[model samples]
Every structure is written in structure tokens, then in C-alpha cells.
Target: MGRKAIYTRVYNQLRYEILSGEIAIGSPLPPERKLAEQLGVSRNTIVRAYSELEAEGFIVSRMGSGRYVEALHPAPSHAQTHWGKQASGKLAAAPSHMAELLSVTDTYPNTINFAHGDGGKHTLESSCFSDYVKSTAEQLHSYYFTSVQGLPELRERLVAWMDMEPISSPEQVVITSGSQEGLYLITSLLARPGDLVVTEMPTYFGSLQLFQSLGVQIIPVPMDANGMRIDVLEGILARYRPRFLYTVPTYHNPTGWTMSLDRRKKLLALSERYQLPIVEDDAYRHLHLDAEPPPSLKSMDRTGNVIYLNTFSKLLFPGLRVGWVAANRSFARLLTRMKELSITTNTLGQLALAAYLRDDALRPHLQEVRKQYAEQAAIMAGHLDRFRPLGIRYERPAGGFYFWVSLPEEINPRQLMTECLQQGVSFTCGDMFLLREAEQPYIRLCFTHERTDQIDRGMKIIDHVLQSRKELLS
Candidate 1:
């Protein structure tokens, strides 16, 4: 073959190896002379191939060492070839934008973090948690691995805990790392490429990522103050016959709009009629500020229609990484096996959390959390009320960490996010929750993550920056 043909063959082979995950990321390629000898090609041909690969961004040449795969993509533009892109059409375009908000927090140590959904400064007391750790450690004599379904005691405790939510027995529960894992496991079992999954328009971003990763087609159902629009959902249900309905019925993440009793019943009724199961992610159920929200769909479900997902991450600490999925006995067993095949649940944390729950500490702690977040939410609302004329629209969240605020159409959310970060405050842009093409004149700010003092300062900064932008647009 000609020298050009030899180099082209070499380049194609190397590119295929890198993209197909055969060579592996960060692993060094053989020396040019060694590779030339191995491939039965001239060293110059191998050098030409390496140079092209480096230029294309498929590999990088280190000064002292050999060439290594920098990324699987040929270029930043070629990154659209991610497994998610091939499997699912719509990708969460917000991670890049959201990273900017996260970066501000990392870069500016004192930057009030309004973007993250985490327990604030006054999180669980160290002494209280230490006590549980001490007690749980004492009880756990062996350091060996436990069941993938999680610690028996933890599952039993969860069963009792779930009784209030009216979820089924311990037999129906399969413990997972977090509700995130539960979502993944269930999605793996049910959804496949080209399958349809329905969700609220401004649903949890994590759920969207999971669905997109599986190559499932996501059909968003619009929501109002009563939560997901059942009227709109009925039309989609009649036409599409989705795989499952994913929703956060109580104190939703971004909007904090709880599904009303009427809507909840209708949603369940539709699920029953269509034989569609519901994945009820009740992550923020305990964070209600004012009054109790409506009963969860799981609680109301008469048939084995709702797969209930609950997590300790929101109310409790995130590091614990304990969550559970409650379904019918048959599905519960399947989930338990799925957990076994994939990864085991956190044993130490589960034991510790079980010990903590045994004392019924969560209720009292939840009361404190409710009071603190309520105060913080009210403080933020008061400040935001002053800036209402700037076209900042929101329904004051009765509970949960976030206030989903809608900006004026003229004001670009990305521009506002950039200016806010510059002024020592940060929030997630609306585009983070939806596709880039979707018109998202919105932003989500977390009140629970910041202290009362920080909320005031942060809101003032946001107010000043946004008011200036509004005036410019005017």
C-alpha cells in the first residue's frame, strides 16, 4: 500500500480502539517505533497517524511520556457522540451551565451557595450522629459484607417509617444506595431504547439524566400549582402509552409545588386505567414548611402501581447515602437481585441510620428543619418581593429547598447567571432543568442551603445585579 494509505489505516485503527474503549482512557500508547514494528508499518507512517490523532483531540502527546487518549471524542463538537446522545435524543444541556454556578462556590470560598440542594450550616449535630455511630459500631462485631438489600434492621425500621406514608410492608422494600440508585435500578428493569417515560416539565434533573442515559424517550407533562396537569397527561396517555410516570408529588425540587389531592387521585386513576406504573420519588416529603401536603400516590395506591422511592439525603446527611424502594413482593425481589448484581447498599451507614431511627430522632430533627427552612424561605421571599417589579415571578415555596423563579422573556437566564456569579451569588439557570432549545425563562435558588444571614446578603446581590439587567433590557 502507499504511505498515505498505511497512515490512514493506522489512524482509523487507533481511533476505533480509543472510541470503542479497547485502549482505555489515560493509558499510554506504544512508542512510535515499537507500534510501527508491531503494525508492520514505517515509523514515519505511525508518526503521521499519532500527529493527526493528537490534532483531532482523540489523543494527547506528553513531552516525556508517550501519547495517551485524552478523550473519546474527536473534538468538543464531536462530544455529541456520547452514549446518552446516541441512546436518547434530548440531553441535559445544563450541567455545563450549572458547573459555572458550582465553580463560583469553589473559587470564592465565601460565595453564598444558593445553587446546591444541601442541608445548611446548622446541619445534624455532631454529637447526635457520633452517638449513633458509636452504638451501631458496637453492635456490628463483624466487618464482613452484608446483604445487597441492606441491613435487615434498617429495612425493618424503614418499613415502620413508611407506615406513616402508608407504603407496604418490609417485604416490599429493597434498600438502595440512594433514591438515585433506586431510580437507576427500576429504569434498568423497565425502560430500554425507544421506550417512552413521562415526567413533569420541571422535574428532577437527576431523573432526566437517568432516563436519557437509558435511551428512553422523555415526554414532559406540563404542571400547574396543583402539580402535573392530569388533563394534559390524559391526552399523552391516550396517544403514547408511556412505560411509566415519574413524579415528585410532594414539595417538588425546583418548583416546590405539591400535587393536590384531586390531582393525585386522578394521576393514580389514570395509572390504573392505563396499567402504567408510577415512580414516586418522595425525597423532600419531610421538608414541608407550612402545613402537610397531600397524601403521596404510593399511600393512595390500591394496586401494585406505585414504586415508592425515599432517601435520607435531603432530611438527613447526604454522605449516608441510604434510600429504599418499595414495590410489590415480586418486583421487590427483582430489585434486590438487581442491587446484588450491580452493587451492595452501604452497610455501615445503613446500620447507623437504623440505630438513629430506632430512637425516633428524625421527627424532632425534622421539626427543627421545618422551622429553620420556613424562616429562611420567608426571608428570601421578602427580599424577592422587593424586586418583583423586575419581572421576577415565583410562588413562595411552602416547603423544600428551592424557589423556582421565572424571569422576563427578554432577560437571558445565562446572562443573569453570569452576572450573579460575578456579584458573589449563584443560582441554577432554567435551562439546567430543560433542553437548551426549550424556552426557559427561569432559575432555581436553594434557601435551605444558605443561612438566614447569607440569604439576605445573597438576595440583595441578586436583586442589585438583576435590577440592573432589567433596566438595560427596558
Candidate 2:
């Protein structure tokens, strides 16, 4: 073979090994001279390959310790494909903290798991839901499968409920098992491997997992109290040209920060400027305890650039697993074909939910749920106010079910979680939210699941744990 062909072969093999996790992150690669000798190539060829890898941020060279693999890149926040399991190569293992959170199984033994984002089961109490289920069961015998894009009635009702502009037609909506599935389908249809995607730093863990799985390169844009820092986003778009922008604009998860009207306008403008699509996840928008929910990003989208996704899980029941997407008619047709090949989301569930939404009972039940969540949020805030330790800070969420608390820098949240679990109070460690291997001294506590007394008691236990570990903080 020619010298160039020989060099190319050696380079491709090494690249494959690095990406497949054969070399592993932070591990020293074989010496360049040794690698060349093994591959029957010149040392110059190996050197050229290593240099290329370093420039691409796949690996780094240390002055004396030799070359080691760099950390894996962050995935997009909106799409499930970006967040799916990594497929070999020099990819770092899923962050240890996220793995620990997912593996936590002692739900009833000792730990009071406030870590999960789900509202307490009490929110499921409603006679209307039972009524709807019965109505759906009666129709099941006569039910033929609905159109691939889902029941036209449900799509029409969803758009009206959100107060979104007229969708052109029912063909523009695709029902899926949940909003997560909708996100996965959208990304699969829109993005290719190596596409750049933008998302908020410390965004939803599931979204991060999906994007990582798809091998999409993620650019983390920092979010502030108002929402995503539009200034930073503009700079990123001009420089990186991401394929899409993913956001949870109203009552954002984890942080519970909503974007302002002005910022929302700027976001849409930025998308138009860059010709990038926006994937808006509005899962928690309907769970507002406050009087007026902010107008959604979808409501504001005018140029057909935004794809909106929402679920009935938080507002009604998660077990139903019913969610839908509002997109351009052409894209929706493509996604429906994808959904048909996958499982047609439970017909019974969709029919039941359609009945529930169509009835007058849903509004009154929602009022009751809103009252309950408001009370729970108040109870949590009151407890935190009375017993919170020095140096701890938290945002008072206006609508959603979570309280995002930031702790002292000296404390390790992972260790604190262990200590709290020992005390029979459980919450998520903040490190799980991060894309990189950095430590964050924060925890997400879900107030909607527990009674007021339970919230008070849990706070007391957490306070004691922190007091006992105060020495560790220093």
C-alpha cells in the first residue's frame, strides 16, 4: 500500500478506538512510538492522528504524564436521542451522581424521596377521572384505531386550551406516549449526527441524556433569574450555528424560573436570524398554582419555527403517559409515521384523557389541584424560612412543584444526600443536573408530594444532618 494509505489506516483505527471507549477517559494512551510499531506505521503517522484528536477536544496532552482522553461532550437538552446512552468510544461513563439517583430503590424503607419531580399521589384524587375512564371503556369496543396523527378532537382541544393560534389542521399534531417520546421523534427527524444543539446549563437531566445518546454536540447557555441569557445565546448562535434551541420557558423544571415577555420575543427573533428551530417543552405549564400562567413560547411563535410539546402527566396522571406535539403540518406527518411504527400510544389512555378534557369536570378538579399545590408550596417555603441554615439560598417558585436550593460551597451535596437518607429524608443531589463532572452544592425538593407536616418534619431532619456535618463544610 502507498504511504498515505498506510497512515490513513492507522489514523482511522486509533480514532475508532478513542470514540468507542477502548482507550477510556483520563487514561494514558499507548505511547506514540509503541502505537506506530504495533500498527506497522511510522511514528509520524501516530503523531499526526493524536494531534488531530486533541484539536477536536476528544483528548488532551499533558506535559509529562502523556496524552489522556478528555471528558465526553454534553448532549442537547430537548431531544431524547441526544440524552440516550452513549455508544462506546472514549466517552466518559454516565455521571456517577445521575446513576445513583436512577438506582435509588429504597422508596418505602427509610428515605422520604422528595427527589422525584412527580407531584404527590394526592393530586390524583378526582371523581371526574373515574368517570372519564368509564366513558372511555364503553367506547373501546367500537373504537377503531384513530388516524396516525392522533384523534382530531384531542388535537383541536389541546390547541384551544393552550390558547395557541389555529394550527392550520389536525395533521399538524402527533400524539405520543409522552412528551419525552415526542422530543425523541422530533430530534430524529430534524438533526443528523454531529449537529450542534443549544440548551440551558443545569437543564433537565432526561433531556441531557437523550441528546448525549444521539452524539449531538451540546452548547450550554447559562440561564439567570429571568430565563436564558439572550445575550449569551446570540453570541453562541453567531459563532456555533446550532441546529435548534431547546427550552422550558414557562415554570421551568428544576429552576422554576419563567422567561420574560421581552426575552421570549428576543429568543424567537434569534431563531429567525439563525434559521434555527425551537423545541419548547411545556410539560409543567398547566400546573400553575398562580392566577395567570405566562403566555407560552408556542403562543408567541409566529413564523412556524417553534415545535410545542406538552403532557397531561403532571396535571392529571403520569400513568396514562399521553402527550402531543404541535408542529408544522409537513413535519407532523413524518413524525406520525414514526409513531405508528413505534407503539401507538395506549388508545384507552387517549380516549379517557379526551373524555376528561371534553367534560366540564376538568376545570373544577384543576382548581382543587392548584389549591393543594399552593398550600404545599407555602408550607415548604415557611419551613425553609424558619429552619434554613446560614449560607443556604433558594428560589420561591411561583407555580411549579419544586424548590431549587443552593447550599454552601464547602458542603458536598452527595455526602449530604447520604446523611439525609440516613435520617429518613431524601432529596436529589445537585451534581446530577450537571453535564460535566463538576460538583454543585444544590438539591431539588418536590413539595407537592408530601403533606405540610411531612414537609416540616423533612426540613427538620435535613437541618439536623447539615448541623451534624457542619465540620465537613469548613
Candidate 3:
């Protein structure tokens, strides 16, 4: 065989091993001469093959050490062939932090996890969810693909479920795998690289991750008690012509500050005046612990400017991976086409969700969840309030799972996280949510997952940590 053919053969074998997990990531490859001898090829052939793997991002070479498989796999090379550069970029830039957050730390006995967003002990019945999938598969019996816009009945059900002022039509609703996919679709289609996208300060980190991957510039507008400051947003609008504004107005993540109705209206007016599109992410709107949240921006929108994204992930179950985007008829149609091209929605799951929604099962379930979360939130707030005199501050969120807490300026947030983990407690670092590094110390805790008793214990652990730090300083 030709020398080129020999190297190609060796390269393909190495690539297959890496992709198939036979060659674990970060494991060193055999030395060039050793590998060449084993494969009955020249050292030059091994060198060329290694270079090929490195170029494609499957492996890397260290200065003194041998070649090692990359820890993070590159996007499938076939993505550009099938979809385009956008698809490739999306897959390649999948956030590393998400993987860290999703790891199976559950195996660690006695570890109190507050890092994840999902229902901790309150997660839905797996057997029932399996039944939904099985029943739908057996009964529905459609060998063909479902509509890209989503199963028709599901779209209709979602529109009725949300019950916005303007009343969305079935045609205006496009189903997505989840809110993450919806955000990705919007970001990919609406704005290109170098375009500006404005977001609230300390906005959803997931959104920030997507924006950064897309090469879109994110301008953060500071938030207050009401929500994203309209005055600050106006200043940004005047100076920079951003392509769109993204906000989690109701039951804001991390901080849990719901936007006041007045601010919502002002935001709508600003969007109208600026002719800027608003991507309103109301993922946690239904998880309201106390009163209902203010009218959604999409509901308040007179023009076809607000693209509303909602998910059942936080409320019902995230594993089902079902969500929807509501927009004007034309844009929604465009999104449907995009969905069709980007790995069509899960047919069986959508049908099951539709059946669940149609039977009016979600409301009763939400009522129970609301009560539980409310109790948990109060317990968490009470503990923090006890530590209030120590300069630790937080807003008692009206509704939502997270408590965004600020520690005393003297304590380092990273150091505090390490200490908390050592004490068998884990929480999200607040800087993960921000577009830039923040000056003061902040952290996010999800109270929804832990049992109230466990939460109390965890809070006491945290309090002890704070008190110890204070003592050291004195």
C-alpha cells in the first residue's frame, strides 16, 4: 500500500477508537515508534496520522508527553455537510459548565446538592412517564414523521394552557425539544456573528453560553427590584443597535425577582419604539410560590415583536424535553421549517405531553409543586434572614426555585463554595450566571430539591461557615 494509504488507515483506526470511547479521553497514545512498530508501519506514517487526528480536534499533543485524546470531543465533522456552519458551531460550543452541573454527584453519599435546577426529591414518577411513552407509542401508531411545527394537538393545547391576552393561535406556536433548543434556534436565525444581543445583567447563564458560542456580543442591562431597568436599556438602545433583547421577566432565574407589571409594559413600549425584537423566556412563570407573575411580554405585545419561549422542564419534568415558542404566524412558520431541518422534534414524547396536557393533568400537579416550593423557599429565606445582620443580603423571591444570595465582601465566593462542598453542601457560583466577572460575592442556591429538614441542616452548615469566617477576621 502507498505511504499515504497506510497513514490514512492508521488515522481512521485511531479516530474510531477515540470516538467509540475505547481510547478514553486524556489517555496517552503509545509513543510514535512503538505505535508504528505495533501497526507494522514506519514512524513517519504514525507521525502523519497523529497530526491528522490533532487537526480534526480528536486528540492533542503535549510538548514532552505523547498524543492524548481530547477531553471534549469536537462537533461531528458531518454537521457542516448536513446542516451548515451554524449547526457545527452550536454542537461544538455546547457549554462545558452544563456538563459539570449535570454530573452524577448523586453517588456521593451525604452530599446535599443545590447546584442543579431540576426537581430534586420532587421529580415526577418515572413509571408514569414511561407509561405515557409506551401508551402513546402503542396507540398513536404513526410510522411517518410528525409535523415540524409539532403535533397539531400539542400546539393547540399549549396555546390554551398559556392563556395570554392576545391568545396565541396553533399556527403561531412551534414546538421545540426544550427551551434550550428554542433559544438556540432563535439565536441562530435572528442574529449572526458580530451582531449585538442585549440581555439582563446576571441573565440566564445557558443563554449567555449560547450567545458566546455564536460570536454574538451580549450587552447586559442592570436589573433592580422591578426587573431589567428600562432606563438603562434605553441608554443601550440609543448607543448600540442590538438585534434583540432577551429577558426572563417573570420568576427570573438565579435571583427570582419577578418583573413588576409597570416595568413589563414599559419594556413592551421600548421594544415597540426601538423596533427591537424581545425574546421573553418564561421558563419558571408557572412555578410561582406566592401570587401569579405579571403579564408576560408576549401577552403585552401588540406588534409581532416578542418571541415567547416556555418549557415544561422546570415545572413538570425536564427529561421529557418538551417546550414551545410562540410568535407571529409568519415567524412561527419560519421556525417550524428550522425545526424540521434541525433534527425533527421527538414524535412520541410530544404526543405523550399532548395527552398529558389535554387531560388537564398539569394544573393539579402544579398546585402541589407550588405549595412545596413555597414552603421550601420560606425555610431558605428564614435561614438567610437570620444571618442578615452579618451583611449577607438577599431578596425573598416571590416565585421560583433559586435564591441569589450575596455574601459579606470579605469572604471570597470561590473559597466559600469550596468550604461549603467540604461541609457536604453544594451550590451554583453566581458568576456562572453573569456575562462578565462580578465585583461582589454572590452564589445561587436551589431550595426546591432538598427536603425542608435537609435544607435547614444545610442552612445551619452555611451559617456556621459564615460565622467562622467572621471570627477569623476579628
**Highest TM-score model number:** 2
Regions of model 1 farther than 4 Å from truth: 1-104, 137-142, 164-166
- Name every residue pair that clashes in candidate 3: none
TM-score of each: 0.78, 0.79, 0.78
- Lowest summed lDDT across 10 adjacent residues in model 3 is found at 71-80
Candidate order by TM-score, decreasing, is 2, 1, 3
* Model 3, CA-based lDDT: 0.79
Give the per-residue lDDT of model 3 (tens digit) for 274-353.
Answer: 99999999999888887788788888889989999998788777787888899998888889878877756788888888
User: What order do you get sorting by lDDT, best first?
Assistant: 3, 1, 2
Better of 1 and 2 by lDDT: 1
Candidate 2, residue 155: CA error in Å? Answer: 1.9
Candidate 2 stretches greater than 4 Å from native: 1-110, 142-144, 166-168, 471-474
Between candidates 2 and 3, the one scoring higher on lDDT is: 3
Query: Which pairs of residues have clashing backbones in candidate 1?
Result: none
Report the Cα lDDT for candidate 1: 0.78
Worst lDDT 10-window in candidate 1: 70-79
Q: What is the lDDT of residue 314 in candidate 3?
A: 88
Better candidate number, 1 or 3, judged by lDDT: 3
